[model samples]
Target: MDGKNALCRKCQDRLWDTRIPASSCERCKSYVEAGGVCRFCKNGGMEHIVSTYAPFMYTGAARTLVMQLKFRDMDDGLAYLTDAMADALPVRDFDLIVPVPLHARRERPRGCNQAQLLAQGVGVRICVPVGNALMRFRATSPQSTLASLRARRSNVENAFALCGDADISGKKILLVDDVRTSGSTARACAKVLLQGGAREVHLLCACVVWHYKGNEKNGSVAGKNGAAAGQHGR
Candidate 1:
């Protein structure tokens, strides 16, 4: 428990007075380990997206790390994202890498977009950030609260729009994101990219929440149970 490294979001107390992997919550006695999704967010189709090449699950030390990365501005944590991105979906020759942008309200407070930070970590030549490339058209209830998959999809339907500057008619796009709870967000963005003129839009993320049937056979999700990616492919 490193106090400087491990700070409880709930209590704001430093763990072990030094930075170290957090084991348990000092206040609630709950475990704060990595590679696990919020047990609170579990039961509702919130399993480890896919063990294979998924974004680091939010459990144990991994969870704590992402928390610090996303909310606490541990900008350096982004380095970890680089390997994950390359391993999750290797981009051999993508014309551009576009990170899904957060709403202005959310981005203003955080002063940054986690997905964009991740894209930077990917170590590829950066094109325009295109923050306005996909506008969050309307605010909706947090996805965590939506228990039904249908509801989740609807919550994001028509919630995104493409930028006027984008020209994808023959370009290949690699869209990046921090996490993928449901394919809804990525799908929405991909639709817009395709309509905007993108010849191919590949969705890449730190993690993919739930992989479907075809994912395994196509190098998408190796094996049914899911494991870290072995070889990166489109």
Candidate 2:
């Protein structure tokens, strides 16, 4: 499905399109560039993440697609996300792919880990092996409940731990997720990776949360608008 060509023209329109405007800083997917760098990237990104890329803005159709995948368990749109993520990725030479893991309690009810599903999709596209390297050992309040960046960081702080002896020594790792807002979650995972001996950790997501920190949650019940044509991957 490209643009308005698919049978579900309305749903297709909600996915990646080449016509959408690209952000100024290609280094870190930012919609608004201030002083040559995205405001968040300037203040919070540079020192922690090597780079982060997301092809679509966190609004409109993009949000709809993500909402469907996460809440309604509609994974058919994963191909679209994989296409967008694969296209936006800056480098392909990565040793391993990892996803922001869900807590055991959270994942049990959700059925499947949305971020893990996304990471697997990206790994297949990029020809890299994926590992569930990190585990959410400490359950924290959802980032959506947090109001500020500090709160979000504190919520996820020290929440992740290495899964096992997945040797990442000096190897570059990619952290996959559905959306990135304040980046506290991604940064928290990356910190553990670096401390565990990963040479580098990069973040990649389907959409970039820009300007506003909306109540963003993955695999949680949200506004369900489209699910007729998006049930599960074939």
> Which numbered prediction scores highest in lDDT against the true structure?
2
Best-performing candidate as measured by TM-score: 2
- Across 104-162, the per-residue lDDT of candidate 1 in tens digits comes to 87678877877787776663533323333566767766665554456666777777788
Error of 2 at 228 (Å): 22
lDDT against the true structure, each candidate: 0.50, 0.69
lDDT of 1 at 202: 64
Candidate 2 TM-score over all chains jointly? 0.82
| TM-score to native of every candidate shown | 0.62, 0.82
Q: Give one digit per residue, the lDDT tens place, for model 2 in 1-234.
A: 331232265555545442225544544554453324554555555346788777776666777687777866554577777777887776799999999999998888878888898898888888999998899999887776655556667788889999886788898999898876667788899999999999998888887654422222322212121221122110
Cα shift from native, residue 50, model 1 (Å): 16
> For residue 156, what is the lDDT in candidate 1?
71
